[model samples]
Target: MRSLLVAVCLVLALHCGEAAVSCNTVAEDLYPCVSYVAQGGYVPATCCTGIRALNTQAQTAVDRQSVCRCIKSAIGGLSLTPNNINNALSLPAKCGVNLPYRISPSTNCDSIN
Candidate 1:
């Protein structure tokens, strides 16, 4: 569906060199959170699962920076409100995933590593 398209686009768009994790994988993992991030409803178990999976995969500094860039790109593509942006930023915490850097478009992905 839409997620698949997003994944494909992300894979083609992200040119952050090679990493264990792909942008397509990143999009897939975070796709489930879109609803909760946009609408601010009950957090879905599937979303949290994806969040945890992403956290586990992004172990190295390079991987983490790639993930951060992917997230920022994804968020930039979305027409989210300020509240929705807040939700997206807080999503990892809600899902029990403590990311080293904040997931905002303003985040400096290059500085992560």
Candidate 2:
């Protein structure tokens, strides 16, 4: 029984979803696909799809800036390095936080910081 359970767990882990990556994971994982696109300096179909997913997912989040920052930091570390993607991205130009996108700290998040 123990061996059967272990085998089943291994199979499940190995055969997980092969579908396109989601933004949440991308945000969490720095959207490795986007990093690949950014590194390539060209937005391919996969990157566009991921971008759309990112925008849609951002709409669902209450704190969008933090998420963007998380994604930015992740993508910045990628070989392509984060550049211009933020400017062209669907993320707001400014948020309460003083994100890398903005020049100064936002008055909106002054209290939180």
Candidate 3:
């Protein structure tokens, strides 16, 4: 019984690990862009790198939605103005990432796919 319980636990853990893109990962990937987004100037190469990386990482519909939600949530937590938000949204295109949807707190993650 103990062995069975251990197996179940392991399986559950593995399943949870594969659930979706983590918010922490999302935050880390976008960290370099915060300065560029908040302020105005030439966008950093590192920022573009992070944006491209995130675009590559979020492949599936579920993964995209997960990333979308994470981005939206993070945006809410920040004190960016409309110009800042515009900068953030424009980062993807500037970085050569063709995001399917806009990155705004108001975006509906459910319709990402």
Runs in model 2 deviating more than 4 A are 1-24, 27-42, 60-63, 76-113
Per-residue lDDT tens digits for candidate 2, residues 30-49, read 23243333334444455455
| Tens-digit lDDT track of model 1 for 1-113 | 36634643565356443678877787778777767876787889988998899889988999988888777776766556788788888888898888888878789988886
Model 1 alpha-carbon drift over 4 Å, by segment:
1-17
CA lDDT, every model vs. true structure:
0.77, 0.36, 0.71
| Candidate 3 local lDDT, 12-67, one digit each (tens) | 23332232666666666777776777676888898788778878888898888877
Q: Which candidate leads in lDDT? A: 1
lDDT for position 57 in model 3: 85
**Candidate 2's TM-score:** 0.37
TM-score on alpha carbons, each prediction: 0.82, 0.37, 0.78
